[model samples]
Target: MATFDSFFSKRTLIGLALGQFVSLVITSTAFSSSELSRRGISVPTSQSFLNYVLLAIVYGGFLVYKRKRSLQIKWYFYLMLAVADVEANFLVVKAYQYTSLTSVMLLDCWSIPSVILLTWLFLNTKYRFRKFVGVAVCVAGLVLVVFSDVHSRDRGKGLPHFKYGSGGSDPVKGDVLVLSGAMLYAVSNVSEEFIVKKGGRVELMAMLGLFGAVVGSCQMYPEILANI
Candidate 1:
């Protein structure tokens, strides 16, 4: 292993910074095309930031490598992460097709309850009633947000802008899908937290990153090939 001085050397930081910059540029460009190809899904840049966070995970794994812990990777946890990642993205995109961002985000409030239960069940994590109250307060705020959005939409030139069944879609169902996706995400988070407590985050994350990529690729490749 490198000495602390060497690991924290100016040369090391410079290299890391340069590598991050290059990675950011590459991922930005690649996903830009992916976004366009999927249709004009103009996601809020801020919200989409996490979508590109896999790169950071990859970098973190490398840091673990430098620390020279264990390099062996598990594939199962990675598979779960990959499935969760793709499902969440798919849910968000499909929700956008049916509902307003406001309603979708409101329903994502489901994550709070889902995650709390997840922690209690899997991690044995606990919280006071006050914490539950805090979650309730946040959920109420989310409801208000959706109400405001719906009101604004109703006042606009077109209200209930989407349809229910054929051709187009419905808003309420979109909210449900968002909630489902959020629940899945919470499950993934809790699962990873459990995994982290048991194993090294670096190796686990690297494995998860690679596994998710492969799983997502398998799901996507058939569709792409069918299109061609």
Candidate 2:
């Protein structure tokens, strides 16, 4: 009871509110991405590329001004992290082209379990039994979500834009993409956590922005050329 009461602390409530706000922002972005796809504009890489540029200009500039401090981690590590982050963002957004926003959001929860496993395996993190129970619950929820999508399709109630087995929009393919992207997101999140703990938030964001911009630009240019 005391442990539960601690969660009601003002600081904790503030943290919870901030986290919820971030979640809402992310959901809003997902809706925007889906709307873009619905409009026949599917430039997932381009979208991420612009965000990376802004991050680079904002955070990267801070790092440049603080020239006294050098990077704590190696550049190659940030390069790998940037690639994973960029690809994860691209895959999740691209999935908007093939699935309902609801399914995409629900399936993205796969990242929770992926993160738990990665942190346990690579970071030597340990969890209590309740954490496992939470994970099991999440898995059950995901199973039900997939089953619901399948049932909807079988009943011909799936979205008109996403017909099962169709080349243009396959829900199964989109789900797979979301799961793949979630796994990559786990990798990026774990790596970022490790780097931030060792170095600092500024260093992590600066390097991530710099490398992410470069990687995003490389992927974006080809996508633009293909569209043209």
Candidate 3:
């Protein structure tokens, strides 16, 4: 007979994987839709503001509404995480605007190494030599992808454009920014894990979404105020 632990292990793993897949699909679809909307269409500031308002509500609801009773949230930690989260997005978007999208995407791959290093440092996690080698190989693959940014120089269609080197599109600056964003995201992930391990209640997807929406709305308050 299978033990309860064994049964749960399989079920939990499957659920987690499925949730991740679904989340990835949803996220990718949203980005694709955003890009399509941008194509040959100039969105007005009012429209963008309205979009942000909707985004805030959507994210807040998705991230933190349902798990109210058991949600042992530490606001300070969340604040730090939120700041990093905001900065990461800003940096990546800026990088995208200033350089080729291909370069930005390629440089974002640094997150793997960033996460491993951070996990080792903060979480005190250890890895086998093979895992370290695997990370190295992955980083090498990222370098190859960066090299292939040559293909991205044709933009305004679907693909990203590239302008490598100085005075054109500095891959160095763009990659650095994207790399930083990836590292920040990794840190945020590890921090969330830490939070959960420390008995912070399992925030339902809906709850998380809600919290994210509220927080995102708050983030835009300054801009809203400025415009007003």
Which predicted model would earn the best lDDT?
A: 2
Poorest stretch of ten by lDDT in candidate 1: 161-170
Worst 10 residues of 3 by lDDT: 40-49
Candidate lDDT scores, in order, read 0.62, 0.86, 0.58
Q: Write the per-residue lDDT of candidate 3 for residues 1-228, one digit (tens) a residue.
A: 887898689788899899999978745733543353335222212222343345446654644555345546655566666556655655665564445554555577687788889889999999989999999998998777555544334432343442333112555566676778888878777776777766443342223334444555666666456545
Write the number of the candidate with greater TM-score, choosing between 2 and 3. 2
Best by TM-score: 2
In candidate 2, what residue range of length 10 has the lowest lDDT sum?
Answer: 159-168
TM-score pick, better of 1 and 3 = 1
Candidate 3 error regions (>4 Å)? 1-71, 144-168, 204-215, 218-228
What TM-score does prediction 1 earn?
A: 0.62
In the range 1-228, model 1's lDDT, one tens digit per residue, is 699999999999999999999978855653453344346443322233344358447755585557665544455666777678667666655566556544664566678888998899877897999999989898887667555544443444353554322112355556666777888878878877877766667655666666655555555555455445
Q: Looking at model 3, how many pairs of residues clash?
A: 24
TM-score, per-candidate, Cα-based: 0.62, 0.90, 0.60
Candidate 2 per-residue C-alpha lDDT over 1-228 given as tens digits, one digit per residue, 9 for 90 to 100: 468779898989999999999999999999999998888887898988877777788888888888686788999999999999999999999988887898899899999999999999999999999999999999999888777665565655555664553222567777888889999999999999999998788878888888998998888887787677
**Count of clashes, each model:** 1, 0, 24
Please list the residue runs of candidate 1 whose C-alpha ends up more than 4 Å from where it truly belongs after superposition: 1-57, 60-74, 141-169, 222-228
**CA shift at 164, candidate 1, in angstroms?**
11
Give per-residue lDDT, candidate 2, residue 36: 87
